[model samples]
Target chain A: MSNTPLLSTRGLTCRFGGLTAVDRVDFDVRPGQVHAILGPNGAGKSTLINLLSGELRPSEGEIHYRQHPIHGLPAHRVARLGIGRSHQKTNIFPRLSCLENCRLAARIHLGGVIASWRSRAAARQVDERAEQALATCLLTHRASTPASAMSYGEQRQLQIAMVLATAPTLMLLDEPLAGMGREETSRVTGLLRALRDDYTLVLIEHDMDSVFALAEQITVMVDGRVLETGTTAAIRGSEKVRDVYLGRHQQEQA
Target chain B: MLHRYPKRVPIIMLALTVLLVFYPLWGPVLIGDGSDFFLEKLTLMLILGLFAMSLDLLVGVVGLVSLGHALFFGLAGYTLALASPSYSAASLWWMMPLVMLVSALAALVIGALVLRTRGIFFIMTTLAFGQMLYYLVSDASFTGGSDGVFIMFKPTLAIGELTLIDLESPLQFFYFVMGMTLLTYLFLHWLIRSYFGQVLDGIHDNEHRMQALGYATYGYKLAAFVISGVLAGVAGMLAAMQYGFANPAQLGWHLSGEVLMMVILGGMGTLFGPLLGAFAYELLHYAFEHLTLYWQLLMGLTIILIVLVLPKGLAGLILDPPRLRLPRVGVGGLLRPRPAASTKARLGLAGHHKHEEG
Candidate 1:
């Protein structure tokens, strides 16, 4: 709610043995903003998200969430702090039904943590919130369907819905449209655009059109460090970005 | 839609308990000759059934397969025999309490030690500890050495100037065992349906995810282990009381193997699977022992067939797998069918409307 950015990382660094996966990467994500972190394969985009999500501990640097230090917190604690994320891989409770999946996430939002033997009232609330989340992704009809039965695109939608049920202040979406077909991608893009009003999303995406359309600000990463960060237009016209990333593709397309 | 009979489950259990309690009364007319012997066998089966259920709680539901369950069962028997007077029937009151106390203590100590390791190491360690106890009992002279201690008379309950329980009466004793089984079954059912049960399921599915989700997986696992251990101990105490003797064979690895087979045969995770498996297996054993002298061979072959044929156990086939159903929603918020199916359902709805109009 404050003018301060929703999240800020100062000198964030991570090391795996002798290799550095994320190196002194300083980044800030403002409130109610769509900030996309763009990079090619093996560019530490995933590593950065893992660090921010508290899946991996940083070797050095501080991460402040809503102006409070949250670097060393566990994944659930980070989630409880109003930060929700979907994994790069379709990470969900596979055997559970679509509604059950959302219910699991929704329970995190409804007062206390949900255990297996929850009261009927808590169970009902979970079901209700899960249905609401499923509606948001237009998959409410498939609420009783198992996760395994869903198509790849629907699985992606369910993943987003699960994250949404957590009621996060900032959503870290890792490749939301990674393996979607054209129609599916457009549908998801439209959905993301629609959600822009209620959510401040930080997306790591490969789809240029969706990124450009949805993101107000873009930061480029190469070899685990932030190469540049600016408005979409500024990033588009950056000579260094063109020479390093876009040069080969721009020429080939032309 | 056909409604599930959730209430039927408990009703059936209550009926079965009543039948078991009065089994001797009817067993004489049904089985004909050696009715008392058969009832005794049933009592043994009931105790073993409880033992099997305890294992199922750990292996089937909690996802911790243990091979040393008989250790608790046999240990309690040993403790009861050692405490009771050898010259006469052990005082049922003293021996029963002692069996429970000693068995629980042994299980707690053993469970704590074995639970520290996991996977194959845990299995092997528990097996070793059980074998060690068996060996110690077999070699010890004061504990009747390898031959085991016997009871001169069945235990009886005495009240001042009033008669109470006569353990020699098969009907009275059978009811006692039945009561214990029902209590154990109900307690276990409640336990697995609790929040603790849910966490165990989560741990079973993905332990790391549970830890990341802020659950102390270690504490949850330990609690489940202790609960299973205590249940096994109670089964052992009842076994010792029923037989009026404790044998070194009670501690043998075969005892553990038999209980495990019962769990697997009945359906590891299913609620009543243990009871089913125990009864079926025991009855089969009785029939085989009478029909053929080589009952052990038949028992081994039958267990092999059950394992090979139904790895998920009998429960998976009988109980039906858990299914997910959609919650009822407001009419306006009803989920639209897939765009492809929408037209067909809409046509069906329209047909009903037109019929009403006509």
Candidate 2:
């Protein structure tokens, strides 16, 4: 497709000392699609998200987000450019109340940083957006609870709520569903599925069934390099993908 | 944790307000000493309290341990000292804002450089800058070098020909210091509760998360640092006006340690705690000085005893209605990370890489 991708990377590479963490790779993340990056634990999926979110600098590459070169920008700068990401470990303001955490995130998108002078009426938008995010994550009931008080699964949900509150055009969720019971996994999967309508989502997740179920497109990375980028059917049906990423268990199932 | 002002808080505030207003009359009576020295000590308490409160903005709100905070305080005092006191035209109109602006600018520059570092590095860099200012004043001829500079007369307030407040009188001067303290407290109270304050609090909890959520954390921190310095400068200005002197020692690392101790002893984050800590420290010093020349030793013992007993500092025992959470070791937990900070990268940005190494 010659159409402009929401976020595109060309020869993106990151090195820690002499070791290359993320090797030169390229992909075009189309607008309004759930592009899932599937990999083993050390496949550098998290590193890719880190580079995208500006947590780590790319050793070599160009990352264009909405036609702007954002590879070298700091995390906050990237965030200001309407790109938000979540951590695999459920990053959140643990001391702050759930609503407060969301409010802090929402205010950045809804208003200026120096908003001390603005009246409550003027900042009503921030509160509304925060509440909406909470509702979307089904965390409205626990809004007043400190984030630390929430169950781990609930905190994971709060993580999504936080990124959602930022109101980004594109979201890079790092392992949005890592540790979850059956119900929470489905709930988050449902949430991710719903988010596809509003946000261009790049999710790094290990849950194959969930990825296949939710993602329209998938990128399989092996040892910091992309094995293949294709539709779920293509990835599932590929012999190499089955042998390497899926293991022999997936081949027997096929 | 549950949080609320105690029922006695309003009563305490009202009582304190009433007592301060009637201080000239009742202050002499209640102290029993009823001496000029007693009143002066009380006034010093109020000014130092303001200084401690300013440091709290950095330590408590932003979770930034600034060791060079005394730079702004001493710089403002020195500005008043170095300037020609010959001009009677310098009123509250120009002087206060001017000192505040200079101090804020210094904080801005210092903050820009120091804020890039975190934890121990941030502390050491601030300490380094604090010493630089101390030495600059101590060695500079314009600053009176180590001998220090002196203000010829206290700053007076007037509008054109109108003589509004005559600061020469000790009682009036005392009230003026108290007025500034109250004003600073009010401004800070408003600030820490504002959207900016909440954002700073979020940044303190998890900077990376705040950044990920789209906040320019560095800007917020720099702004907070400037606000903190400006308030501190205001305190220094008041102190300079009162003492009619600006010593290089005021800029020294010693003062930084003292003020940090005050914030920690009073309770790091609470608005009123620093003031209480200042009062506690000053009073103990005063009481001990009266008894013996080796007052510092006794002062140290008392502070240690007090800190050990009230781990959350004076504010925990006296001001904060709710216990909230247990106090971590380290003054206001400056050395120890906040409870939430341990899990800060819970979404696992830094942690994910550890596995990458394996």
Interface RMSD, in order shown:
12.9, 6.4
lDDT of 1 by residue, A46-65 (tens): 89988988889999999999
Candidate 1 local lDDT, residue B106: 74
lDDT of 2 by residue, B112-227 (tens): 99999999999999999999888888888988889898788777787887877788778888888888888888888777877788778777667887888877888989999989
Candidate 1, which CAPRI tier? incorrect
Tens digits of per-residue lDDT for model 2 on A1-73? 3367999999999989987878998988999888999877788889999999999999999999888899889
Model 2 residue runs over 4 Å out of place are: A1-3, A119-122, A248-254, B1-4, B32-34, B87-90, B160-162, B319-358
Each model's backbone clash number? 0, 7
Q: Which stretches of candidate 1 lie over 4 Å from their true place?
A: A1-27, A57-74, A108-132, A139-152, A194-200, A217-219, A223-226, A239-254, B1-22, B75-118, B125-168, B190-196, B210-214, B245-253, B284-298, B317-358
Task: Tell me how much of the true interface, by contacts, candidate 2 captures.
Answer: 0.55
| Residue B264 lDDT, candidate 1, scale 0-100 | 84
TM-score of chain B of each: 0.81, 0.86
DockQ of each: 0.14, 0.41
In lDDT terms, how accurate is model 1? 0.77
